[model samples]
Target: MTALVEVVRSGFVESVHHGSLVVTTPDGAVRASIGDVHSPVYPRSSNKPLQALAMLRSGLEVADDDLALVCASHNGEPDHVERALALLERAGLTEDDLHCPPDRPRHEPAAEPRRAAMNCSGKHAGMLATCVAAGWPTADYTDPGHPLQRAIADTVSEMIGEPIAWTGVDGCGAPLLAYSLTGLARAFGRLAAGTGTPRRIADAMRAHPWLVAGTGREDTVLMEAVPGLLMKGGAEGVHAFALSDGTAVAFKIADGNARAREPILVETLRLLGETPKDEAREAVDRMAVGAGVVTGAGRDVGSLRVTGAVAEALGTGS
Candidate 1:
């Protein structure tokens, strides 16, 4: 296990986060790693791009921005909802065809719940479009035995280079596939370097970072700051990213706090001798790490930071 992050309070060590991470080349060779990288884990929504590939294979077609939405876990801002609805319209479907439950927009915290505002709505819309294009049934498209799901399973198996060890329901009620962290890294490497569908998906993500996430969100902000990075984070502490040079990293935090992701991402890039641009660095800096200012009553009382092996890897000594 790797000591990935620490919570510091009033000059005392409070808690620590442990996890595993792996970096790979475009060819899927391991470049660097910490902790166990072969254990099967659910990557959650991080696998959206690959799912979009399955949809494409089923004859779903749309503009790049819409395609990007199909690969998004967006903030459900106005544009996101609009595009999702538009995708459904293209298929002669509607919000009623979506299986993802209603939810308030993540970007607009105060907004009311809406089916189209769910982060996974765009993905469901894509699946519906695929069903329409392939002459399949829309109502049960989320079923594991549905043709769409079978095709998705095949696509995931091919990309990860292994049969899935588990199948579970995702937060959005869609199938969730499990793969080893290294396998996830390898798939992301291919997305970054391969031609055809993989390249097209990556291009769409890079070209429309906002659709991929939203304004000021980590994924959108990071992609905007760094010209050619394709990044996506998943629920329960999973993150995957690839650089244009074909270097990729994937990790999971033992504790499900997403705050631990970016520090390791930046550190991994640094370890690979790739420095983020100044603006990108600043964006990452503003993110809430596991360790940082601890305040009570609006006054700074202490701080937290990365410590232990991962911190050492980041070249920040404890």
Candidate 2:
């Protein structure tokens, strides 16, 4: 790993975040890299878009906005929960069929925990819908040996152009597959530029960015601010996205610090000439101002900024 971002307080470097990052050209060739882009890592919820594509391939049918929710790591707001329940109702199922663990809304700490309010519930609902559509058993949809999971595994391997390096259980209790960051970037690039299946997933996400995340979220804010940009972030500091031109970026912060993610992503996009323009520019600027800043005594005192190897690889140093 290499120093991907640094925490600066009063002009002094207080700490550093080590990580790996890879940028791919429109055709999926590595344009720049830092740290171990080739190593396999569980991409967690970042894999939702790919998993949603797999469900679609298996005959899961839903409205575009619902499909966007299928690719979400949502904030579990009322709209998100309602859409999730609606998908289950349409499939002749209910929240009881959802396999993801019950949890409170990410955006509402005071709310009660419910399966439908779990961030991964939308995905679980989609999985059940696919099973219903395909005439597969829904009871064990989350099992690795289930038809839906096998299909998802195959889809992931095919899209990433790499075999699964490992299989593990995700926080949502679904089967998780691992692949290199380079392969992950390639998959997103394909989703950005390809037609048919990949295009459908990308279009749904771009059309309903709010469902994919929520108010004030980095994924929602950035995707809303940048036209044709598809972004997703996972647990453990993983983030990936692709531009309209098919250029893609993927990275993982070694220490799993979420605070460093946005600054690094914003800097990476800026370095690659993908900065938002016109009206959207102001939205992105506002979002950036809230990222990575440190506060003390209720005042701004420091910030986490992209620096070292990743910055240098992108033709900047800080």
Candidate 3:
């Protein structure tokens, strides 16, 4: 089945979000999907955790607390910035070692007063620290063929149970690879199952959640919602999540509607027997309706309509 998120504003499709998804339990059972679960796709920010796991094995001296930051797509808040800065300090390095170009903070409007918290900063800082620890040159750190990049690429390949056959540049100028949604889900399953997730990787994320995402971000919220659950969302309507109990889900919006993400996300979670609390459900509901524009100027307008054979399997739609 396929779907597109419609912008009620102009009743037009601003983006295309067509892709498959796979829901699997830690025990390795396939649960449900809406499209081609085995279709290859880029992992995006969702790959951070895998990169961090490789860093652990590469002999990087990052503490568990710092490991979390390494795997995070932070909100670039003051504290998030401070931690990223501190990571640089700890490695006796600085941002110059980072090859990722700077950009505007991911969260604006409310946090407009402070501009330091760009989502990629923490990841960049972690990359810089790794370069320092490895005694590798910081120049061209973003090079796809760089030693660090190679290590991460290999790590990602190993996690997915398939060799990466292609590469592309990411929004932050790092190497990006394609993999089937099942491959992505399997990777998360490995992490959640702690099969391939290094101690450093898990400890870092579990110990310092805030560094993973400042005060409140979806990554933080999901992790908080399901304690010990490692979650990450990528740009272009992609999200990856793993329950410590062994369930994992990977999805992409065929039409890249960030709004559709909420219901799909909650729906996926609910399939895993997770029923969000009133507050959490409400929060997800808001995103479902284009960020709090739910309920007809005051009604519950949040929803998703799963159709076709895939929907037949799931048994529901908007």
Name the candidate that leads on lDDT: 2
TM-score of each: 0.93, 0.96, 0.83
Instruction: Report backbone clashes per prediction.
Output: 3, 0, 16
Model 1 regions more than 4 Å off? 288-293, 299-304, 311-318
29-118 per-residue lDDT for model 1 (tens digits) = 887777898889999989999899899988999899999999999889999999999999989998988999999997678888888999
List runs of model 2 lying over 4 Å from the truth. 277-283, 286-292, 316-318
Ranked candidates (lDDT, high to low) = 2, 1, 3
- The TM-score between candidate 3 and the true structure equals 0.83
RMSD in angstroms between candidate 3 and the native structure over all alpha carbons: 3.9
Q: Which clashing pairs does model 2 show? A: none
| Candidate closest to the true structure, highest TM-score | 2
1-318: candidate 3 lDDT, tens digit per residue: 465343343333343345567777675567776667776777788888888877766667766767787788777666777777788888886655555666556665454433235577677777767777788777777788888889988988888888886799987777888887777887887787674455346556756767787675766665656566777788887888877776788888765556556555655665556655566666654554455433357654443433233344455542
TM-score of 1: 0.93
The lDDT per prediction is 0.84, 0.89, 0.69
Lowest lDDT block of 10, candidate 2:
283-292
lDDT of 2 by residue, 1-318 (tens): 689788878778888889999999888899999989998999999999999999999999898999999999999999999999999999999898888888999878888889999999889999999999999999988899999999999999998888999999999999999999998999999998889988999999999999999987889988987788999999999999999889999999998888888887788788777767676776666445333377787787877777757667876664
